[model samples]
Target: MGELMGRAVQRVSHEHREMAAERLRAAAGDGLISIDELDRRLGTAFLAVTFADLDAVTVDLPPAPLEVVAAAASRRVLRLAVSNGSVSRFGEWEVPGEIELQLEHATSTLDFRVSEVPATGVHINVQAFRSRVRLLVLPGTYVDLGSLGRHRSTVADRHGRAGSSRELHAVRLTGDIRGGSLRVLRRPYQLF
Candidate 1:
């Protein structure tokens, strides 16, 4: 994406960079780009400050089919509801594009160390009280807590590196987390 209506080019977010990086990685995997080219584009993607900068990362690649994009966007959101116990997801499991966590006096673990994350990234809308939600993500995954609203709750994020990886995706945390805790843990090494 570039300048619109002769207006200023938009600034890029973690999601934009991650999406561009995914495209570059896919191009490399499909033999459309060399490892060196992929590395160069990934570096650009992570360092991109503007949408124009991110656009350059995959300007040479083809656009995703509109139908495929719509399908991905329309994927149903996963709801993880708990009230008095725990729910754990680890090992190899399919990760959805979005999740709405409903918890009360409960605890849950969403482990993304080994999973097929969508290229578009994931959104987590949380609603909790007297609960604990733990997220175990890969080292390179980008987690944004800007939209999270917390009261009497603490969020511990342990996986924020200065830069990102091309193979990783973005995760945004939103909604309210009350009288509880949201802990984000990063696995030092990937399982897959």
Candidate 2:
């Protein structure tokens, strides 16, 4: 649990830092900060390596508009339960803060490529009994199976079992899998 919490303070990508810096610039334009403050925050934002560091750059700025805030908060959790059947969640869906999946002798497919990921990341708890769950995620997102323990169920990832860079959004999976299987695959990059 301690390790998980430590990992939660994730390193953010350069793009994310740049976005935060842009937001700071926007805020300054709105008179939230002076020109000098904007320059200072912009410098800090570019130098920020972690999400927390970038967040600090404009933490004192005014909140976003109500509509945007509501829309973001609305994408909370996606819960699904199945018994002896196949369930699929994909395409233009919002990846919630937590995905709770309960399966009993069933199969599930979850695709995150076409989904919107939350800023803080996502957590997936799959409780299975004699079922199989297939999770298709984006390139940077990782699947951590450390807490899965020694159940009859097995977790396999075609890309690799090791966690990706901390800069990527993390999907922490924790649950009991008795006589079931969990497969995590990274989607192929598409150029369109």
Candidate 3:
């Protein structure tokens, strides 16, 4: 076993690939790159194996803002791993700016009704298999369901599109969920 392989490459994780895809999507939405360019980069991103391979996709984009760099430095990220059965995040829990979820053969409930979600928005990178994901959102909360994915899944979005809102998105769903479903519900308005 002495045959030496080429220089070792630190393989990129699922979360990293999804994050890069999200960045490309955002860049396209912000008019930073053309749709054709976005399509080309997305293809490269999905097929990327190493960190350098993925990095090449977003290499030309401008770096993230200084404030975002600071926020990342402060470590506002959440990672959840669950297998089988159901999972829920509700009842005034701390909602961070970035979330990574790994679900296997499970049902997930993400209720944002009674939580103090970040105004800047939340970027969720999910890697699911044979699972159902339900998101409970309220009115006036911008939701972006248009993100990159490579899965055999279905999404039943009841919240519909954002109407006349200047905000980009209050919650942006990214990543892939294979052989399952994504259902979004708009919680009724409450004046309590």
Candidate 4:
């Protein structure tokens, strides 16, 4: 844990920098910065290599809670292995840093509309053979498709709310599929 914290402070990833850029965009949207300022900060954010560098991008903006940042940074991964059945998660479930789903002849649905998302992000790893999986995320959620091998996949709203606002959390989907289907859908945030 100490080591991870140390590393996080020293090295910044592209994702981290992008997150900072998103924050800057959001600040601009909130009338906190001018367009020229936004562009300049975005350029610096993209080139940021350390946590401090990323922090500098949003230093003038209102600070997010420390607990939120810590919780986002310290989330654990959730793993699910199933065969020949159906599994679903919805309604106020706690989302982990990552979800690894291994399926065989099964079906799964993960609905994030009513789920609790950590401050960082959620990663879904779908490893399936002869199965089906569906992921539902809210309107503000960002979905990044990473490495995918085989199978039929459909992602609605592939480019979501980009540059409009900051995405405090995201759902990253990756993995391999064989003779299976995977679908990612976006739904409006519900008040009910």
Candidate 5:
């Protein structure tokens, strides 16, 4: 009876090992497991070949295709129009090539950076009071800021090269900025 019990335990252990191998193979094919990671996991399995050991292995499984889910979640577009107030403490805004912005009714401090803009156009119109607006533009891009008003405003093109592309992208900002601040950073691509 003792020998029989030992044999039964050995059989269960082998079954657990086989199950682990199968899971490892599936995970590898699914691109969830690198060969080195798989080897490490298998080594851990070999050290302890019981049901509880296998359960622990299953618990440590790497996430599956989470990038697609994350990208989908972070991708967004915003069109905001604020009126009859002062917008202060606006920070750097980066605009990617794929991003589209139509902003109007902004009143306050405005600081903006424009880089790597792949879009065909953008429209901005803003009004400010005792606020400073700054814009930085990249090379080979066009930006049209319609009617900007403020205590101080500066448009600087650091690319040092004349923009050869005559394709005018329009940004229209229309509002009143009274005693506040706004800053925007624009990138070549649309970012979340």
Candidate 6:
């Protein structure tokens, strides 16, 4: 009875080790593991008399690499302005030449001015909105809106906003002359 019990334990241990070896092979791609190492580990596992020995033989296996990679990538610089169709959403705006602006699905007309080739500051007026407006700003730039009012605006920064500058980078205004909301984001490398 004692000898039969010992043989049964040995058979289970050997099966467990074989399963562990198969798993290791699946994780590490072709040719990564040497035939000698595989044979050695398998021999150790088959001969392992204790659970501790079987556990030790299966340790230290590497993880598999991801099969799919995402295609869309992030950009370094971006400027966006949007508005819906309402009198008090966006009005008049100004932007420095150093920065570039992209308009998306905006119903209201935009009045923009850039003093130099690369704008240093920006201004925007939100005259109307049937829907909310969204804007994305890049790093190392400054944004300013002298005043913002009404219509509940939200600004999100993935990294953070820029520091102070001698000049401005961007500015925006929304809604009618009296009521609405205004938002500004600035990224300044140097503070003078």
lDDT of each: 0.76, 0.71, 0.74, 0.73, 0.45, 0.39
Candidate 3 or 1, higher TM-score: 1
Best by lDDT: 1
Candidate 6 overall Cα lDDT vs. reference? 0.39
Question: What TM-score does candidate 5 reach?
Answer: 0.27
- Model 3 misplaced regions, further than 4 Å: 1-74, 148-150, 163-169, 189-192
Clashing pairs in 4: none
Worst 10 residues of 5 by lDDT: 95-104
Which is superior by TM-score, 4 or 6? Answer: 4
Poorest stretch of ten by lDDT in candidate 6: 67-76
Task: Estimate, for each residue in 1-192, the C-alpha lDDT of model 5 and write its tens digit.
Answer: 987556445522443454465566568778887989888877877776455565566566654243332232224333333455444323445432222222233443333333222223334444444444444343344444334444334443344343423254333444534454444444443344
Which residues of candidate 5, in runs, are more than 4 Å off?
1-118, 149-192
**lDDT, model 2:** 0.71
Candidate ranking (lDDT, best to worst): 1, 3, 4, 2, 5, 6
| Segments in model 1 whose C-alpha atoms lie over 4 Å from true places | 1-74, 162-168, 189-192
* lDDT, candidate 3, 1-192, per-residue tens: 222222225665554566677778778988999999999999999888887787789888876543443353225788887899787897667777778878999988888878766545677888989998888888667777777374788887765775432253368878998998888888763645
lDDT of 6 at 156: 38
Better structure of 3 and 6 per lDDT: 3
Q: On a 0 to 100 scale, what is the lDDT of residue 10 in model 5? A: 51
Clashes of 3: 0
What CA RMSD would you report for each candidate?
14.1, 12.1, 15.6, 12.9, 18.4, 21.4
> Which has the greatest TM-score?
1
What is the RMSD of candidate 6?
21.4
lDDT of 3 at 10: 64
* Model 2 ranges with Cα > 4 A deviation: 1-75, 161-168, 189-192
Kindly list the per-residue Cα lDDT of model 6 for residues 75-150, writing each as its tens digit: 1123444543322222223222222232333332222321121222334444333333333344544444334444
